[model samples]
Target: MRQLLSYGLFGVIFFHLFFPHNISAQSVDTVYFSLDMTEPISEGWLKHGTEIVGIRGDQSPLNWGNTFEASDPDKDGIYEVAVPFNLHSDSLLVSFKIKVDGVNNPDDGWQKGRNHEAMIYQGVKNKVTLKWADEPPQAPTTITGQVEIFRDFQSDNLVPRDLYVYLPPGYKESNQRYPVLYMHDGQALFDASEIGQEWRVDEAAEELIRAGEIEPVIIVGIGNTQNRFDEYTPTEQVWRYELNRISSQERTTFPEAFAGNYISTEGDTIRFKTKHDTLLTMIPGGQFWQPLIPESEHAFFLAQAGITFTFDVKETEVNQVVASKPTMGGDGDLYGGFIIKKVKPFIDQNFRTRPEREFTSLGGSSLGGLITLYLGLEYQDTFSNLLVVSPSVWWDGQMIISKVNELPGATNQHIWLDMGTAEGEGAVESAKALNKALLNKGWSKENLNFVIEEGAAHNERAWAKRVPDMLRFLYSKN
Candidate 1:
C-alpha cells in the first residue's frame, strides 16, 4: 500500500512506499470526506467498519486508487477522513466506494450500481449525504404498499432479470384481478442510490389509490441488468449505431465533432461557434462532448486536461446515459421478447393480473421510454397502453418515428406522451414530434394525451410527480 504524506507550511510532500524507497510526494491541499454513520451504526444497522476506496483518478502506484480507513474521532459513528492526497487538477472528478469491511466481505454492505461521486477541484471538501453503501430511502409511512424483489428471475431465452412487484393495499385480501403496468428501471423507480432520485411510483400509487383518483393497479418494475442500454433499445440496429458512435472517438474535438464549430478558448474554456438558434453559454459537457467517453475513464480524461468542462446541461444529463457501456451492441428485441414471453407469464402466474392487452401496459423514461415506445408500437397486441415519458426519439437518426409512420395502422391504443419544459431542447422537441407521429398514425385526442409539463425536469422526482396524471389518463374508465 502507498501512503500520501500531506505538506503544511514547509510545502513538502513525502511518499512512503512499501519497498522503503522514499520519494517526495506532490504538494496538494488535503480534501476531507466525512460520512455520518451515526444513524446506521448506533441503530445496530451497520456492524462493520467502513473504508473509502477511490475508484477513479491516478491510482498508478496505489494499486487501483487510494483506500483510506475512516476514523470516528468523536466515537459517535460519524467517520471523517482528510484524504491523504490533494486535488491535483480542477477537472478531477472523483468516485469513492465505501466498502463496509472491505470489498467481497459479507459484512461489507453495498448497493449495486451506486457510488459516491464528486467533481473535486483544488481544496474541495465534501460529505457523503447518503448512508454507507447507497441504502434505499425508507418507505414512506403514509403509503400502504410494499416493493417485493423477485431475485434473479430466470428466463429461458434471455439473461436473468430481477422484477420488483409493487402491490397496492388490500391486494392480498381481495381476490380481484388488477391491471398491470410494466415499467423499466425497476432498481431506480423505488431506490435513490441507483439514481440520485427515485420515481416514487409506489408512493404515488398509494396516494392515488387512497384519494380515489386512480384505480388500484399492480406495477411490475423490471430491474435492468448489466446490459441495460442494449436491452432497452428496440432493435439491434439502434444498439449498433449507439455502441459505435459512443465508443468511437472519431469526432470529439471542436468545430467538427460536437456539431459546434470551435471559436476560442479562454484558459481551458473553449468557445464553440454555435450555429443553432438556441442561445446557451454552456451545456452539459457529457451530453454533447462526452457522448464518446465512458464515465469510468473520466479520471483519466481529467488528468490529461487540467480543467474540467462545464455546460448549461444540468444533472438530468447524468441519468440519461448511466447504463451505457463500451461493449458491442446486440439484439435488444430478443431481450424484449423474453420479457413478453417469459417474464410476463411468470408475473401473471404468480400474481392476479389482467392478462388482456387492454389491461396490460408498458412504460419507462429516457432510453427505457424509447424501448417502451418501440415495444408498444411493435407489440401493439401485447401492450395497449403506454406511459412514454421523454422517449429518446433521436436514436438511430430518428428512425423510430419513421418506422411508426411507415406502419399502417389505426390501432386503438391509450398513449400518454410527455416531456418537461425544462428538459433539454432536443428532448422536448423530440417528444412533440413523437406526439405528431402518433396523431398521424390515427391516434385521436381521446386516445392519446400529449403533455408538456410546466417547469418539470428530466430526473426521477420529475417523473414521479407526473405518474398520477398519466395513470389517471391510462386507467380511468370514465
Candidate 2:
C-alpha cells in the first residue's frame, strides 16, 4: 500500500508535468511537454529571449487548509500546471524553477534526483544533464554532454531507476567505440559533482584510461529499482515456509500466513537487535529521526507482537502478503530480461562500447551486488566479470549462499567481492561462505578476490571511497 500510494502520487505528478501549461484536448497548440522544465534550476537562471509561455502551480494539495496555492514539486521542481493560453510570441521566454537542493535533491521519488541548487547539483553538472526540451539546449561550449535519467512512469514498475553515460572529452568531434563499465545504481555511484558522492567515476576513468592503468571504460550506472528485493530475488519470493495459526477459543481467522524470503533479520542478527524500529522524519526544514519506541523494551514488545510471518519464494504466497506488487526495491531478489538485455544493450550501444562480452563487466553493491552475482553466474555468456560489494548476503533467501557453489569456475572469469567489517557478524559469515564456496570450486586467488574493510559501513561514502579501486580491479589491465 505504501508503494502503491507512492506510485499514485507519481502518476498525478507526471501527468501535470508532461502537460505543464494546460492545453485543451482539441486545441491546435496541442503538445505534451510543450513548455517543460525537466531539470531542476538555480535561483538566478540567465538565458536569452523571453515570453511568458504559461504558469502552472504544482498539484500536490493545499497544505492543511492553508490555501497554500502551490507545491514545490519534488521532481525537477517545475511546479507542474495547466494553462489555457500559449506563449505570446514566436520567441520563448526563459522561466525559472530556482531551487536550493541541500543534502537531498527532491524528485517525485523517481529518477536520480536532487535539490534545486545545492552545492552538489551546481557547476560541472550543468554539462552532465540534458534538459528535456523540444530540442537540446544550445549549451555553452564548456558544457560537454547532455544526458537524461529515466524510469517507468507506471505503478507496476516505479523503481528508483536511472543510468549515467559519459561523453569522451572530445565526443562531438569523433565517433569512437569506448569500453563500458555497466555499473548498478548509476544515480548514486558518481561523485557529488553531479549531486552525488565524490568517487567521480568519469574523472577517475578518464584519468586512468588516459594513463593506461585501465581501458577507457564509459560507465553506465544503473540505479536500483525502488523495489530492489524484487530485482535481486530469482524466485517470486526469497524463501518459502508454511504458517499455521489458531486462537484461544480454537478459532482461527486464517489457516496460513507468510512473506516470501523476507526474513526477520532482527530476530537472528545482533546488529539489527541493537538498532530498533527507527524512522527518519524528513520535513521541509530539516530531517531527524529516533527509535519509534524505547529500545530497552523493543525486544520484549516485538516478542509479544509475534506477527506470524514466514518467508516464501512463490507467487501464490507473495500475493497473500502483498495483494498488489512490491512497493520498494530489495524486498527479495530481481533478475529479468529488461535489465539483462534491454538496459545492457542501451548502455552498450549509446557508449559505442566494444560489441563483445570479453570487455564487458557487471558490478553493484548490497542487493545490487547479489543480483550482479546472480546475473554473471546465470548469464556468463553476457557478463564475464562480477564486482559484488558488501552484498547483503544474509538476505533471507540466502540467495548468494545458495548459488555460489554452482558458479562458473574462475578460469574463465574474474570476481571482485568485498565486505566491511563494521557490518557485523553476518558480514563475516557471508564473506567466509563465498570464499569457501569459490575455493571448493577450484577457483584461484587470481580469479577471485575478496576484501574486508575495517571500518566501512553500509553507506554511499564507504562505497564511493572504494569505487576507484573496484574499477581498477575490474577493468585495469595493470
Candidate 3:
C-alpha cells in the first residue's frame, strides 16, 4: 500500500458547494481582469502583432493547464478580460496569473510567486489590475530586523549560491551568541523572493523576539539551485515492476513465478528476470518485441503480455507496482555534506553563533523538508532540532518512513512535523505515519510536535502563517 492519508471535510464541502463544475448562470459573477503590459511592450518583449497576453488560473473559464485570451480593443497597453464565477455566497476567492505571448513561449513571460488572489462579492466591481507579471513584488517597508547577504557563496559539494542571513535585533552592541536556524530555499524566505510570495520569516522572528515569546535566533537562508530536486531527496528512485494476471500458459513463459522486482541494469539495457529464469530485456529508449517492450526509458506499456511495469522509482527496493513517472533525486547526502562541511563552518566562523548541536536547527517545506528529516536522522550530532513542514513523505515510496523504522531508537531531539489538511490526503497520511513511526522508535511526545493545520495549502503563504508557532514550539522561553 502507498501508506498516505488527510483531507479537510469542510474544504471539500466548500469546494463542492461553491465551485462545482456545473455552476448555474444565475449564480455567476463576472470578474474583470486588466494587465498593464507597458513594460513588456516598451522592452520589445511582447511584439503587438507577434504575441498577445492571456490569463491562467484555478477557476472556471480559467485553468493552469490552458490559457484564456485577453484583449486590448482600444489599442492601449492594458489588456482586459472578464471571467464569470459561480458566487452563491457573499464572497469567493480566485487565484490567477498573467501569461504573455501565449502558453507555448516560456521566454517572454510567466507570472511569478503564489498565484495572484482576488475576492469576488455580489454588487462589487470585482476588478483586478496587475502592473507586471515577471517581476518580484515591491519589498514591504514593514520588513523587521536586518538581512546580510553573502553573494554566491562557494561550496565544494554543491553549486555556488547566495546565502541570506537574518540577524536578530541588538547583535552589534550586545556580544551575545545566539542559536542558529538554517532554512532551505533562501530566495523565498523574505520579501525579495523571486516569486512574489514570501514566507516573511524575518518579520515573524522579529515579532516573536520582541514579544519575548521565543528565544532570538539567527536564521540562515540557504539558496537553492537548478539541482533542488536532486539535492533535497535522500535517495535515487529506481523502477519497480509487478506481475499482471494472465493466462496460465503465458505465465509459464517465464521461468519461476514472482511478484515483482527492481529493474536491473544489464550491459546496455535494463532487464527484469523471474526466479525461474524467465527474462525480459530492452534498451532504454529503443523498441523491443512488438507488445512486450518498453516504449521509453521512463515508461513500459506491456499490458498484452500479462506483465505490468511502472515508471515510478522507489528509494528503497519494493515489489509492488506504482504509476508515477521517474524523476531525479538522490543527491541529498551530498547537499547535506555541503552544509555540514562548508556552509555551517563558514557561518560559525563569521557569525556570533552558539555552534552547538542543541542550538542549531534545520528546517524547510516540501522537498526541502524531506532533506531536513533525512539530515536530522543521519547527523544527530549536528542538528538536534528539526522543523519539517509539509514534507514530501510520498517521495520514493515513503522511504523516510522505512528509514525511521530502521533506527535503533530515537535520539534526544526536538522535532516538529506538520502538514496542512488541504495539502492532500496522501501527504497528511504520510505525516501521520511518520509521527507514529517516531513514537514507535521511542521519541516522547514532549520532544516531538505534530500539527495538522486546517485549510492550509502547500505554499509560502501557508508556511508563513505557521512561522510564529513553529518558533515558539522550538524555542519557547517557558
Candidate 4:
C-alpha cells in the first residue's frame, strides 16, 4: 500500500511535466478571478470581495490603445483568464487586484487610481461540496456566512439578479414561515469584509433578530443587474436609446465570447473574468433581459478610458427615470403586468410568505421605495403594511402623494416612512414633504412612523441599519 501510494504521487508529478509549474496550487488554494480595468477598454466587471473581476477575455496586456477589453465571456477581444474551480475550500475571499503604472492596493487619498476594476466572488462553491483544507474561505454556518449569492433566478438568462436571504442558526431545523423583508441591492447585504460598501444587511438582521429588537424576519437581499439601470429606473424605457449607445460601446469593448480566454499580465496578474455560456434560454414563466452568462470563468476587462462616458450613461438613470415600458411609459399601467403578477405569486408559493392583504409588506429606497408605495396603494388589498424608505416622491410629478391624500387613511394599514438626513441633495426635505401629506390625510403620529438616520447615506448600509427598526414598525400591533 505504501509503495502504491508513492507510485501514485510520482505518476501525478510526472503527468504535470507538460503543464505550467505556476498553475494555481490545487493542493493548497484555488484561483477564483483575474482582473484588469483600465484604458480605452470598456470591459465590464462583477463585484467579488469588493474588488472587480474582468469578465472580458479578449482584452489583455491592457496598455493604452488596446487597453479596452471584454470580460467574463472573453470573446470580446480583451485579455482573459480562466479561473479554476476544480479545487474546493470551506469558502474564500477570492478576487483580483488591478494595478497600473505601479499603483498599489488602498492608495492614499492623493494618488489618482490606475487600478481598473475587477470581479468579486465570495462564499463557497455551488451545492456546498468542500475539500480538505484546514481553513477554507467560507464556513458551513450562517454566522460564518454560508449564505451568499443574492441572485434572482426568475428565469435562466432573462434577468440574472442577485439576492440576499439571512438563514438564522435554526433555519434548516424549522419549517415555520418567517416574515420576509425584500431589500434592493441584495448583493451587498451581508459580508462587512466588503468594506464600508454594500449594506451589511445580513449581519444587521442577524444581530437584531438575535437581540429580540426585531422579530426573526427573513431578509430577501437581491442584487441589481446590468439591466438594473433599465429595470430599477422609474422611466422604464426612457433611457433606452442612451443605453443602446452604451451597450454598443460595451459590446464592442467587452463582447461576450462564451469560450475561454487569452490573457497576460505584469508581476503575475491574470485576467480570469471569462463567463459561462450554460444558461436556460427558454425559462418557464420568466422575463429575459440579456442572455445568461454561464459560470464559465473568473476574468476581467480593464477599460482604460471612457469611464466618464459610461458613468454619464449609467448614472443618468440614478436620479431620473432611465426607461419605461416598451409600449407603456414609466407610469404605464399596461406594461410589466405579466412579470409583476408572476413574481408575486411565485414569492407567495415558493416561500412561506405572509399574505399581501394582511401581514405582507414591501419597501425600497428612492425609485425602489416609490415602487412599493405605488404598488401598495394600487393594490391595497395585497399589501397591508407599508414601509417606504426614502421613496422618490418627487418623481412622476409627485403624483403618488396626491393620490394617497385623495383617499381616506385606513386604520388597517401601517406605514413606516423614513429617510437619511444625508440621503441626497433634497432627500430629507422630500421625505418630510410626503410625511406632511400623510399626516394631513389623517395618519396619526403613532401609526405613521418616521425616522432619519443621523449619519447614514443613500446606500445599502443605511438601509440595513434601519431594517430592524422598519421591521418592528411594520409588524407592530397598534
User: Against the true structure, whose lDDT is highest?
Assistant: 3
Task: Please count the clashing residue pairs in each candidate, in the order shown.
Answer: 5, 43, 4, 84
After superposing all C-alphas onto the true structure, candidate 1 shows an RMSD in angstroms of 16.3
Give a tens-digit lDDT track for model 4, residues 350-373.
666554466566666766677666
Q: Local distance difference test, per candidate? A: 0.58, 0.45, 0.70, 0.43
lDDT tens digits by residue: candidate 1, 1-478: 1111232101110111111121236545444656666555665645432223222212111111223445675777666665544333453434445544332334334334444455556545544444454543444332237777888888776678788899988898999999999999887776665554578788878888878878889999898886776787765542111101122223333322332322221111212222332211122121232111112322111111111223222322210111111343345688778878887998899999999998999999877888888888788889999888877776665667887798787577788889886454345777878888889889888988899987565566678889878878876645
* Candidate 2 segments whose C-alpha is farther than 4 A from its true place: 1-161, 170-175, 191-199, 238-335, 407-411
Could you tell me which 10 consecutive residues in candidate 4 have the lowest summed lDDT? Answer: 262-271
- TM-score winner between 3 and 4, please give it: 3
Using lDDT as the measure, what is the rank order of every candidate, best first? 3, 1, 2, 4
List the RMSD of every prediction in angstroms: 16.3, 17.8, 11.8, 20.1
Per-model TM against the reference: 0.57, 0.51, 0.65, 0.48
Instruction: Write down the RMSD of candidate 3 (Cα, Å).
Output: 11.8
Please give the RMSD of candidate 2 to the true structure.
17.8
Give the least accurate 10-residue stretch of model 1, judged by summed lDDT.
Answer: 9-18
- Kindly indicate the candidate among 1 and 2 with the higher TM-score: 1
Model 3 stretches astray by more than 4 angstroms: 1-142, 239-326
Superposition TM-score, candidate 4 onto the true structure: 0.48
